[model samples]
Target: MVALAKKKEWSLLLLLAPALLYFLIYHFIPISGMVMAFQDYRIFGKSPFVGFKHFRILFASPAFLQVLRNTLIISFMKIVLFFPLPIIFALMLNEVRSSILRKFIQSTTYLPHFLSWVVIAGIWIAFLSPANGGLNQLREMFKLAPKDYMTDKGAIRWVLFASETWRSLGWDSIIYLAALASISPSLYESADLD
Candidate 1:
C-alpha cells in the first residue's frame, strides 16, 4: 500500500508538472509584474519606489472617472438587466409543441448569436437604416416617418440592449432547457395521479 501510494503521488506530480509550470510562468509571473505599478518602472537598474502616486493620478483624472462610470453602466446593463430575459425566452420556447417550428425558430435565432461582431454590426446597420431598411420599411408601411436609431444617443442604448437580447435570447435559453429537462418525471406523474 505504501509503495502503491508513492507510485500514485509520483504519477500525479508528473501529470501536473507542465500545468504547474505554465501557471507559474504565465499567470504568477505576469501578476508579479503589477508591483511595478507602485514603483517608477525602468528598463535597467532597481525601480525607484513611488507608493500611491500612480493610484492618485488614476483617481484624479476625470476621463478615468467617466470611463469607470461607463464601465459600471454597461456592465450593469449586460449582466444584471439582461440576465433574466433568456430564462423567459426558454420557458416560452419549451411550451411550443411543434418540433419543426421549434427547430426553425431555434436555428434562425441561434444563427445570429454565432455571427462575428463585424457581421452583426453590418446586419444592424442594414436593419436600422433610415432609407429602405427592414425596420424603416415596416415603419413607413404604418405611416410613421423613418427614424435613424443607430446614431441617436437616446435610442442607441436601447438598440444595444435589444441587439444583445436578440443574439443571446436563444443561446442562453439552452441552459434553461437543460435545467427543465433535469426536472424529475415523478412530479408530473404525481400531479396526474392527483
Candidate 2:
C-alpha cells in the first residue's frame, strides 16, 4: 500500500512539473522586471531609482484621472449588470428539453468566448461603423440619423459591457448549468408531490 501511494505521488508530481516550470520561468521571473517601475530605466547602465515620481506624475494628470474614472465605471457596469445574466441564462437553458436546440445555443454563444479580443474588437467596429454598418443600417430604416457608437463617449462603456456579456455569457453559464444538473430529479418529484 505504501509503495502504491509513493508511485501515485510521484505520478502526480510528474504531471505537475511542466506547469510548475512554466510559472517559474514565465510568471515568477518576469515579476522581477516590475522593479523597472521604480527606476528611471536606462538601456545600457544601472538605472537610478526614481521611487514614486512616475506615479505622482500619473496621479496629477487630469487625463489619467479621467481614464481611471472610466475604468471604475466600466468595471462596475461589467460586474453589477453582467452578474445575474449567466445565472438566468443557465436557468433558461436548463428548462430547454431539446438537446439539439440547447447544444446549438451553447455552441453559438461559446464561440464568441474563444475569439481573440483583437478579432472581437474588429468585428464590433465593423458592426458599429457609421457608414454602412449593421446598426446604422437599422437606424436608417427607421428614418433616424446614423449614430457613431464607437466614437460616442457616453455609449462606449455600454458597448464594452454588452460586448463582454456577449463573449462570456455561455462560457460562464456552464458552471451554473453543471450545478443545476447535479440536483436529483427526486427533489423535484418530492416538491411536485408536496
Candidate 3:
C-alpha cells in the first residue's frame, strides 16, 4: 500500500498545485500587507511602527464617531428591518397560483441582483434625481416639492436601505423558496385534515 501511494504522490501533488498557488497568490501574500496597519506607511524609505496611534486618532475624531454611528444605523436597518422582507416575499410567492405572474415577478426582482453595485448606484441616482426623475415626477403630481435624496443626510441612510433591498430581495428569497419547496406534501395534507 505504501509503495502504491508513493507512486501516485506526484499525480496527487499536481492536482493540488493550482489551489495551493491560488491561496499563496491571492490570500497568503496579501495578508503580509496587514503589517502596514501598525506602521506609519511611507512611499519612500522604511516606514516606522506607529502601533495604535492611528486608531486612537480615528476614535477621537468627531467625524469618525458620526460615520461610525451612521454605519451602525445602516447596519441595523439592513439586518433587522430588511430581515423579514425576503421571507415574507418568499411566502407570498409560494402562495401565488399563477406560474406566469410568479415567473415575471421573480425575474424582475432577480434582475437587479445580477447588476454590479456601480450600475445599481447609477440606476438609483437617476431614479431619485430631483430634476426629471420618476420619483420626483410622481411627487410633483401630488403637489409636493422635489427632494434631493442623495445629498440629504437624513434621507441617505433610507436610500441605502431601499437600494440594498431592491438589489437583494429576490435573490435572498430563493433560499426560503427552496426551503418551502422541500416540505413534504403529506405534511400539508395532514394539516389540512386537522
Q: TM-score for every candidate vs. truth?
A: 0.72, 0.87, 0.87
Model 3 per-residue lDDT tens digits across residues 61-157: 9899789899999999999999999999999999998999999998999899999999999999999999988999999999999999999999999
* Candidate 1 weakest lDDT stretch, 10 residues: 66-75
Query: How many Å off is the CA of 62 in candidate 3?
Result: 1.9
Off by over 4 Å in 2: 1-19, 42-46
Candidate achieving the largest lDDT: 3
The digit string of per-residue lDDT tens for model 1 on 52-135 reads: 999999989978977797678777899999999888878887788998998888788778889887888888889999997899
Look at candidate 2 and give me any clashing residue pairs: none
* Candidate 2 global TM-score: 0.87
Deviation from native of the Cα of residue 94 in model 2, angstroms? 0.9
Score candidate 3 by lDDT: 0.96
Clashes of each: 0, 0, 0
Q: Backbone clash tally for model 1? A: 0
